[model samples]
Target chain A: MLEAREPMSAEAAEVSRPSRRGTLYRGDPGMWSWVAHRITGVLTFFFLFAHVLDTALVRVSPQAYNEIIETYKTPLVNLMEVGLVGAVLYHALNGVRVMLVDFWAKGPRYQKQMLWGILVVWLLVMVPGAYFMLVRTVTEMFGGS
Target chain B: MTLALDKPRTPRRPAARRNNWELASWVFMRVSGVALLVLVLGHLLIMNILDGGVHRINWGFVAGRWSSPFWQFWDLAMLWLAEIHGGNGLRTIINDYARKDATRFWLKVLLYVSMVLILALGTFVIFTFDPNFDA
Candidate 1:
């Protein structure tokens, strides 16, 4: 037996069409960067809230604070610290790009170029950063010789 | 015969209620963003890249850093600026995504409540931090 398909509305038809102009931002690099910025910003904010609370544990007692903080020193969490650094770095670098786009005389013309520039800078910074951040973990796990 | 023109789109808010708050918020994001790049990057360098990373961080380490007024001020500034900056970013996101008025209002209420609590708690911790608590 043949199955019946539901009719598509004009809006759904437009969306289903393989047209480049269907969406406003249309998955451009600018749009992706904005998406990343939002994601990173929210993640960083939640982390900040937790960080403040954990730091507040000092008031309770050193042991209490240290016990919780110790979890941050573990290998898995150290890896996450690297990821956090990456997120913050991208957010910061792209933030400057956004500022330049808004304020600089020729910024709008070079926004794409600046995005590429920031990504390069982000890579250069993050490589050495990740290495330094994970060195202790690596050494500890592998037996420092 | 002349063709009739379509009515112009209505403005979202009344002209009488116009203000520079949005412009100010836009400016604040860029300015605070630049400041945070330096402040946060420096913080990361000192805390996570120098000597040993999180391995060296403990109550004693925190005590040592907070003992200096310089580090204390650095941390306090970082906390306040970062919180405000992040809060504003989230507000923009909420406005963009929440279609219904009630949804938008409740989301913002939650956002502001958390922002206030975090700011208050962080400020309190920085000010009342006792380096000799365990002593």
Candidate 2:
């Protein structure tokens, strides 16, 4: 603990560089949704940007776009597809939780309980989805008729 | 102000603000994200790689793709889900970063407007796509 404290002291000075007063909402557990929504939104947006660029290449030259699309036909692309959709789904679902907070459904008192609910549902849905993406399709694709 | 679930936790005050919205938004992101996982990944596999690849995709392909009610519903679901999920995610960002209440409100108005427009347009395209316009 002492060693951990020693290295962090220098970083702590940087961390505490304060923003304007009244601007900063001292965070609670629920507030993390607001933060995560931004992070995952931005991450998903980045992938979307790449997708648009790839697809828009069709507009520039259909061949070029098709060529790119052809490359995405690979197993690597399947994994990427899974990742991209996973990112979008997680961001969207957690974002809904954040919206519920806005409407005042789950508060600080129930934050922990609601967070667990969120996790449970996320895994439940995503696991099946992952199977659909990674296992079922690949099995069908590669396994000979 | 406090709201009670099992029992009334807090007394109703005349002008109490609200509880945390941030949490619900977080939940939305996760839930919709899981749905998208299925919709989007299945879409990619069926469309891009399952058959002989992009060469197999053409006008008849487009018509054939949408022929399935399953794919149509899947696309429709993905379109609206992504839009709402993305829109709500943006709303969270706005609440966090937007400085003024007026600014936040107006920005969200714009976001929601765009969301509705895009959602409508995308759905319409899916439902009424003309695969044989030049045929």
List chain B TM-scores, each candidate: 0.88, 0.70
Cα lDDT of candidate 2 equals 0.60
B1-135, model 2: which lDDT tens digit per residue?
A: 255554345566455438656556656666676687678656755653455443365445555666788777987898777777777766766776899999999999988877776676666666766544442
In candidate 2, stretches whose alpha carbon ends up further than 4 angstroms from where it belongs are A1-37, A43-145, B1-34, B48-59
Residue range A1-145, candidate 1, lDDT tens digits: 1001111224334444457555664554666777788888899998888988898898788999999999999999999999999999998888888777776877766766888999999999999999999998899899997
Report iRMS values in order. Answer: 9.7, 9.0
Clashes per candidate, residues 3 or more apart or on different chains: 0, 41
- Tell me the deviation in Å of residue B85 in model 1: 0.6
On the 0 to 100 scale, the lDDT of residue B57 in model 2 is 56
